[model samples]
Target: MGLQPIGRRVAAACAVVISGTAMTLLLPGAAAADHTDPPCGPAADACINLSENLSWLMSDGDVTFGPVPVSHGKPGYETPPGVFQMSFKNRDHHSSIYDAPMPYSVFFNGDIAFHEGSVDQQSHGCVRLPHDAARTYFYDLEPGDVVEVVP
Candidate 1:
């Protein structure tokens, strides 16, 4: 057969095996693939570690950060995952529920936003934090920053 596209896995080499020692190196294969576009690193000053903080309740419709007030959903009905770009910013727009005005809205993954939301792990599946948490998250981020929503 001619050279056809075949799935290839670079076998784990003994020299590259991760051992009991602290060692940092560029990974092989898909290791370089950005989990989200624009590549979010804690050092980038634009990364938000969403997966580490909350759970995704696709059926419930919100997210909860302890001690932070609850927030409701945005206008759109779908929460997207994977790499997405921040579309816009809304500081005064009202949420669909709770009737409480949030101070910040960090829109990412298309219409999905990581804004001041309920601290209950609800919503279509967006990572929701409290007002202060959201402010801190958004404040540290600029437009066009990449966000990762992992399960």
Candidate 2:
């Protein structure tokens, strides 16, 4: 079969080495030929998959980190899905509304942020990540960076 066309981002991320009639594709964290594009487009620096409860950090469409577990809003307080710009960041933020400590907080949408929290528990509307992941996101993502939430 002939190869199909791929976008620049996908091609760049998937390193293909063709030798004779054999082709080898090298992708980190991939066990098979799963070369699907990241949840958000190339512009997104962070992408959250709500259904899968996973998140990723990207740079120019290449995944820099993750597929890490995350906890998002539950039921009535569902995490909104859309592309948003990272509003700001706070290393140690306390929630005035919930009276909770949010460390390494990276705010994207209004009142919604990615923070170090319990991944097993449901959040009000924020995306809860582990301490390490939260810290990485806070340090790596800057204001105006794209954060995309997908259902």
Strongest candidate by TM-score = 2
* Residues 50-102 of candidate 1: C-alpha lDDT, one tens digit per residue: 43343221111211112223333334743444555566668765657555554
lDDT of each: 0.43, 0.80
TM-score of each: 0.46, 0.76
Q: Which 10-residue span in candidate 1 carries the lowest summed lDDT? A: 56-65
Off by over 4 Å in 1: 1-78, 96-102
Model 1 residue 98 CA deviation in Å: 9.8
What's the residue-level lDDT of 39 in candidate 1?
A: 24
Model 2: clashing residue pairs?
A: none
| TM-score of predicted structure 1 | 0.46
